[model samples]
Target: MKEDSFLKNSVLLTASNITTGILGFIFSIYLSKLIGPVGIGLYGLVMPIYNLFICLMTAGIIAAISKVSAIYKVKRQYNNISKTIKSVASFNVIWSIAIGIMVFFLAPYISKYGIHDMRTVNAIRITCPAMVFIALSNILKGYFFGVSKIVVPSFIDILEKAMRIITITLLIIFFKANSITALVTLAYLSLAIGELQSLILLFIYYKNLSKKTPSSADKPERASQLLFNVLIIALPLCINGFLGNLFGTASTLLVPRRLASAGFDASTALGMIGKFTGMALTIVTFPMIVIMSINSLIVPDLSETISRRDYYNASLRIKKVMKIAFLLGLATTVVCNLIPTSLGQMFYSRDDLGAYIKIASLSAPIFFTSSTMFGILNGLNKQSIILRNSLIVSAIEIVCLYIFIGIPGVNIMGYGITLFISSSISLFINLREVQKHIYLNLSKSNIIIFTLLSILIFMILRGLTTNILNNFITIRNIALILITFSIFIILSFFGIEED
Candidate 1:
């Protein structure tokens, strides 16, 4: 892809993510209010299982498709590209069907034994069919990413999210879902509607592309060979994803239990976990939508660069991306710290949202850095090292939660501390490994000094503004956000520059 194409695609994807993030944020706030903390807790409980199944069904085919398709496009092997997609799609369909069946049969046991909530059984079962649609949508998305036709996938993403929100909102209004079981079931069912819509859109796009593009006369690879190649690239990633998500799910599920052990009853513990995960963490990680979109757009470009042995350009790209990521991360962290309570109150109408936000904000820099580094490492084909790092940190995080979360007075705050520690370790491990392949021009002293200076300035300005505004929460929060954003922009212009 040309530089202009890369930039355009990145901007488009980022814009889409921002739009979707806003919608999702609003949806979450509404859902939280409607369902309350207990409902949010139940919703959160169901998601880990949903995500694990989705990951297994897709089996890393998305990345594999993007990588393989990009290589074939560069080589002008359109027929091979077609064959690859077909093989992957076939494999994914089979896997998705099998997984769906398993989920349908095991829903009762999973809800009862795995999550310890019989209320989730219907919701889990209702979500199983969506996995088939999700599998199909992902295959097409991967193909689009591979061919550098991101517009289709970006538009489809927005459409899917919109559909889900609209469907759920309508269902809630029409059925008056007052109970947790009804609301959760409706939410899961809406997911199926959204996935189905996405599948339809992608199918149309695929058919049109197939009709327009000329078929190559070149003999295609055997089906078994194509499947073998895809598995070779995808299996390791799938294992990494499965294991990582499994551990992540365990850690989250343990939160309410640990809270209960700390002194609270089951209901109160679930509510606390709900507030922490469903409210606080959601707001803290809002900016991640942009970062993750950029990462997705860059991975294919990075793969193409590596394929051409253009290490210098790749290094330049990595440095510029990392610098921008770090600045954004630091700026967001400072802003969150400055007005955590204001933001929490503004978004969730909860007095304690601020506390959880403050604790989670400490992980901002570490989380952002680790996430960006993971994408770069994947682009560089360092899957094994990434897997190892993920496993190690996940183990440490789980251990930390087990040991600290149940301690008296520790409670959910222990999860926050563990998040910071785990992300920091992962970031350092990734940075060290990344340096082996490319020289990173990270100005550690400058970043540290700038971050501290920015934080100090934000605190002083926010304090003065709050006093001047007579502690009007809304105005104060908006003023602080605008001021901090302005400062970040100014600093970017004067201090940070692309290499």
Candidate 2:
């Protein structure tokens, strides 16, 4: 694709991601309020397991599909692309069905022993069918990404999220599913329906796109060989995903247990975990939606650049993207620190949620930067490095969670500190590896200045708003603060460009 087209695709995907993120954020707020802390806790507890299953069922096939498809598209081998998609999709479906069955049966054991909550058993079982739909959707999404048709996948994302929100709301109102188990089950079912909708939409798009492209009448590869090739590319990624997520799942599950060990009861510990994961961290990572969208769009471009041995351009792109991500992270950190209390009150109506957001916000820059670095590494085909980084960070996080959660003084905030340290370490390692290939033109002074200015502006405006408005947590005050902060953020960007 041309440079202009790449830029347009990036912008389109970013806009879609921002819209989806906003809708998802709003949905989360409504769900949290409707279900209360316990319901939120239950949902949070089930997520790691769900993610693990997804990682297993998809088996990194989506990424493998994208990479393979992109290469084929570049080589004008359209037939091979279809064969690749078909083989991967077939393999994914088989695995998803097998895994779904396992999950359906093992839900009781996992809920009883793994999570220590029987309340999640039904939710876990309900999540099983969703995996099949999710697997198919991922295959189509991967194909779209590979072919550089981001709009299809991006639109599907927004549609899926909207469907989930609408379905869940209607179900709750019409069915009055107020119990934690009922709500959680309904939530997972809505997810399944959303995936089905996305799958159907993408299938239609794929059919149309296929018809438009000329077919090479060449003979296709044998199914066995195709599957083997796909697995060669996918297995390592899948293993990396599985092991990394295994540790992450363990760490997440351990949080409440460790908190309990620190003197809290089951209910209190789970509730605290819920508050951190569901409310505080949600607010802290909201900016990542855009950052991640940028990463997604850049990966394929970076892959194409690397394929053509264009290191100079790739390095420049990395530096520019990372700088923007860094600035956004810094701005978000400042905003979070300045208005965590007000934010929590506004979003979840809980002062404690705001307090936790303050702690989590400190990790914002590291999280954002790490994501960018990881994208660069992945684009460069350094999957092993990415995997190693995940392992190292997961280990460190687990150890930190254990040590700090056991200490009475640290408690839940230990997770926040762990997040900061692990992300910093991962980013440091990624940067070191990245510099080996191309020197990153990172401006330390500019970053320092931007950080200082953002914080200074945020504090000044925060104080002014609070004094003038008096009601700090009111919607009007929050709106004024947001508008001022946004203006400062824009001005800061222009100032950096001038420097």
Candidate 3:
């Protein structure tokens, strides 16, 4: 792939991701206001259980298809691309339908025993259909990413998020849901509706696009072979995702119980989880969608390069992705630290979230860096390594949460502590593994320079924006962000972009 085209596509997708993220973030603010903190906590509780099962169905399918499809597209094996989607879509339909049925039937048992919250039963049931919708829709998304046809999925996603907001709003107005269960169930119902719309549109677009493309001159690849190509890549990732989410689900569930053990009541514990996870962490990680948009393209870009033995460009891709992830994270850290309370009050209108936002922001840089490693490893065909490392970290995370959250004073602060430590360890291990295969042209001194300069910029911006317009939280924060990026853009053009 041409670097210019790759950069162009990345920029386009980044714009789309940021737009969708902003919409979704705004919806979260609305949801938090409507549901209140404890309700957000209850909603948060059932989501992990929902996500855990979704992982079981759709986990690595997208990455797998994207990688396999990119490699095939490079080799001009268009038939294989069609075959792969068909086979995977069929499998997903059967498998996901079965799983959805099971979840629907088992929701009550799972909610009571697995989540330890009987109130979540209906909400859990509502997610079963959404899981099925997502399972099939992902095949089309993966294909689009692999073929570099990002615009279709990007538009669809933006529309889906907007419709999601509208759907939930209408549902709430029409039903006037009073109890927490009724309200949370409406939220999940909106998710299912949104996914269904996405699935229908994506399938139509994929079909129309296929009809326009020239069929391969080469003999058609077998359905079995097509399935194998993706499964070989997808299964390891699926296991990694599934087990990682499994451990993640356990960690999430244990938080409330552990906090209660630490002397907080059940309601207070849930409220703490809601403030930190739903509000504070939500705002802090909102910027990560930028990193994710870039990383979404990384698997395909690196896969194509590696297939042609283009290790040089592959290394460049790796180095570039890591740099962007780390720097964006650092910028996030500086802003969060500079005005944590202001952001909390600005976004969610909650004073209690100030402490959580401050603490969670500390993990930004390391967590962002760690997240970039997954795409690089996938490009290197190190899915097994990803799986192994993820399991280890997942195990470590549970242990960390168990020990830390049980401590009385630590309470919800344990989540922040665990995030920082886990991300650092994951980054160290995964980065080492990646370097063994290809040398990253990473500059050590530049990273140090960048870190120090980021601090300096933070001080300068805070002095001007954070305090002077402190009363105007909205204007002050926006001005700080705009000025920070403007300076960085100017620096990049003059000196920073050179070396």
Candidate 4:
């Protein structure tokens, strides 16, 4: 592949990712308003379990598909690529049915033991259809991404979001007159609709593929060996994903349980969890859209470099992505922290929720860094390393959330503390891994000077400016964001690019 071709592919993938991020972020605002904090908490509590189950059902086949597809495209083996897709898709279909059956029987148990809400049981049952849709959508997405066709996925993303917004908005109005059972049912229905729309768009795009077979240069190497190879790679990835999802779901279940043990009423405990854990984290998580976009674009390129044993190029790509990610993360953290309340009020008009936003602001950089690092590790076939690191952090977080919530006076803030500590630990592990593969070639003088300047600026403009900005919330917050970003960009101008 020529440099220009790679650049074009990267640009499309990145743009699609950015579009997904923006649309997904805006959609959250609607969701926050739809259910309020308490409702958001209920949804959050149920979602972790759903996501955990989904990850288990999918078995990390999505990453395996992308990895195998990249190899096949590089080798120009068109026939085997088709076989690989059919095999993975078949595997996904089988598990989807199996999991759906399991969830059908377990819904009552989940509702009774998990959140004690019958409405959530109905929601769990309604969400069963997403299993099949998500499995197909993810597998196809991996194949398209591997083959360097991102526009279809991008378009499907926008379509899915549109369906979600429309479905949820109409359903919110209709469900208002019904029970909580009706509301949760509507939410689940909207999720299934989005997944179906995405899968349909992908299927349509895939149908056009027979007209354009792979060129001679796109033929793949040994087909028989590739399946086993990809399966080997996918095993640890599956475990990593399952553990990660389980950690999240466990935290959700444990936090509220702990809160109740600390003497809060059921509603108050749920409300506090919903406010801090639900609203703040969900809204701030928009940056994930950006990170994921870049990750998708990077994976094929990373795999290509590794396959050819171009360690230098792989190191350069990793460094460049990390440096840029750090800058973006720092900028977002400063901006969000400075005006958390204003941003929260822009959507959900709740001061307490806004406070939770501020508490979570510092976590942006940690999450961004950790996510990208893991992506790089996955691309480099360092799957076991990622699994170990993730498991460590997940264990720490679960214990912290569980023990902290059992304390006498800890409330919703305990959740924030757990996230902060866990993310920070994960970031350290990722940084250590990055250093093992890529050396940071910066001069000590330049690094120290920039570090000092940033800290000084942050310290000088800390509380007073934010207090003053609160008086003129809208304009002042925007001004602060622009000014901070401009300064950061100016400082970054002096940094050297990774070779």
Q: Is candidate 2 or candidate 4 better by lDDT?
A: 2
**How well is each residue in 8-36 modelled by candidate 3, as lDDT tens digits?**
99999999999999989988999998889
**Per-residue C-alpha lDDT of model 4 across residues 319-370, encoded as one tens digit per residue:** 6676556666677677777678777776567776666786777776666767
1-499, model 2: which lDDT tens digit per residue? 4678777877888899989998889888988887888788889989889889888877567777777788777778888888877877787888899999999999999999999999899889988888888888888877887887877778878988887888998888888887888998888778777878888898999989999987877776777786777677667778778888899889989998899889999888878888998989998898898788777767678888987898878887887787767777776777787777778888888877877888898988778888898678878878888788888888999999999887888899998899998889988998999988776656777777777877787777667766565464576545754675476557544533321
The alpha-carbon lDDT assigned to residue 137 of candidate 4 equals 86
* Index of the highest-TM-score prediction: 3
Which ranges of candidate 4 are over 4 A from the true structure?
Answer: 1-10, 172-177, 215-227, 408-410, 437-451, 456-472, 475-479, 486-492, 497-499
Report the lDDT tens digits of candidate 1 across residue range 1-499: 4788888888888998888888888888988887889999999999988888887777577777788888878777788888887888888888899999999999999988889989999999988999899988887888888887878777888878877778998998898888989998898888888889889989899988977767777788887887787777778778888888899889888887888788999889888889888999998888888678877867788888887898888987787677667667777788888888778888999878888888888888778768897679878888788789889999999999988889978898897899899988988999899889877666667677777877788678766765565458888777777787677766665454334
| TM agreement with the true structure for every prediction | 0.95, 0.94, 0.97, 0.90
Give lDDT: candidate 1, residue 224: 81
List candidate 1 segments past 4 Å from native.
468-476, 493-499
Worst 10 residues of 4 by lDDT: 214-223
Candidate that would win on lDDT:
3
Weakest lDDT window of 10 consecutive positions for candidate 3: 490-499
What lDDT does each candidate get? 0.83, 0.81, 0.87, 0.74
